[model samples]
Target: MPERQAFRERIRLEAAERFAAGAADAEVAKDLRVSVRSVRRRRRAWHDAGTEGLRSAGPTSRPKLSEALFTVLEQELAKAPVPHEHDAVGDRADAARARFQSPGPGPPGDRARRGGRGGLGD
Candidate 1:
């Protein structure tokens, strides 16, 4: 991913340089192996923010749910029935109803129930 980002940044820099040299968007797109739309977008960014705009913005960080909220969600999910219990039914309606019923305990090999991190298990 980092390598891909670096390559993308290089392309953006090259596009910006070509644009600064008064190259057409189509030419820059073809030369950089990118879409003309990308070239136009890079040109707009360059015009709006100079060389800094040509640099990668880096990955965006998303906020995770708070532990309290996560716990609530886990509790809600825990109320759902186990998938294995419905497997033998062979009936679609029964299977659907079973899927919505509480599953009770975790299945074998469930890391969360085995005291591993990140699940409804305490």
Candidate 2:
């Protein structure tokens, strides 16, 4: 989980403490730079389930790449490309993906057919 989310949860837990102390939701919201509606909801949760209700759910979804895979990818991207002769593929998509070309001497049509990032070919 990102540090920001954990920090935000800590903030919400703090709000819960304030709620337990009888602080108003609006006051907590203003102090925390959050919506009054959000404070009201948190307050309700604090009353019902206490601190557990305000905890982070951890990651919302599984990552497409694992940490090890992501680290390998970053390392691969950081390496220099092989020496080759090839025409530039596209003005934009090629620019984005140019750093990672196949071992072949030319740009493959695969990206154009499968659709480049942001559907640059489309």
Candidate 3:
């Protein structure tokens, strides 16, 4: 993955350099074995934010949980084997489900049916 990213960055850098040297998009695309549209996009990004703009954006997702909560959850998950590891999968799954059930309010799907905010109900 790192090698692929490095190759992509190298391509962007070379494309930017060629475009700055007044190379046509079609020519740069052919030389780099990439599409002319990609070359043009890279050129626009370079013009807008220099080399930094050509760098990978990395992952777009942010964690759904807070860092502290995520850390606790990770630790908890690490302590237990997955349900499928048991000889009796169905029983193990049921036991695991019961162990993690929400103790708040009414029975399982009741709140969901009542138009409550979250959960698999919706």
Candidate 4:
């Protein structure tokens, strides 16, 4: 983690001293050069919760996708091979150029065709 800024450390230390000496949070705010609401927040966080409350919540995490599910998909894909149709050399060159330019997850029908379950092979 990065070091705390000099101004923030100063404010926290001064505010802590004022709070410990029985000064009102608003008084601490005025003397420490910070907001009254911030003083109250820091006081509650320090007294009621401790250092954890003063720390950032940190980044959110996404659940990991199952490796077993990916293995199952690979197994299914290996069971059958789909036929591919090709045109003349000129058309093939144009198609390759289009593929390089767009490169999208083509159409859903193309996926089904490659999967061997669509009517094209049937």
- RMSD (Å) of each candidate, 1 decimal: 18.9, 15.3, 15.0, 19.3
TM-score result, candidate 4: 0.37
Model 4, span 4-120: residue lDDT tens: 554575567667667778999777878877898898889887787655455454434542647788788889889878787665987889988888895656677886667766555
Clashing pairs in 2: none
- Misplaced by over 4 Å in model 4 are 1-4, 50-122
Question: Residues 3-63, candidate 2, lDDT per residue (tens digit)?
Answer: 9988999899999889889988788999999999999988888779889998988888898
List the candidate 1 regions with Cα displacement exceeding 4 Å. 61-122
Supply the global lDDT for candidate 4: 0.72
Candidate 3 root-mean-square deviation in Å: 15.0
3 versus 4: better TM-score goes to: 3
Q: TM-scores of all models? A: 0.49, 0.54, 0.47, 0.37
> Backbone clashes in each candidate structure, one number apiece?
0, 0, 0, 0
Q: Let me know the TM-score candidate 2 reaches against the reference structure.
A: 0.54
Higher-ranked by lDDT: 1 or 2? 2
Candidate 3 runs further than 4 Å off: 61-122
CA lDDT for candidate 3? 0.87
Ranking by lDDT: 3, 2, 1, 4
Model 1 CA lDDT for position 23 = 99
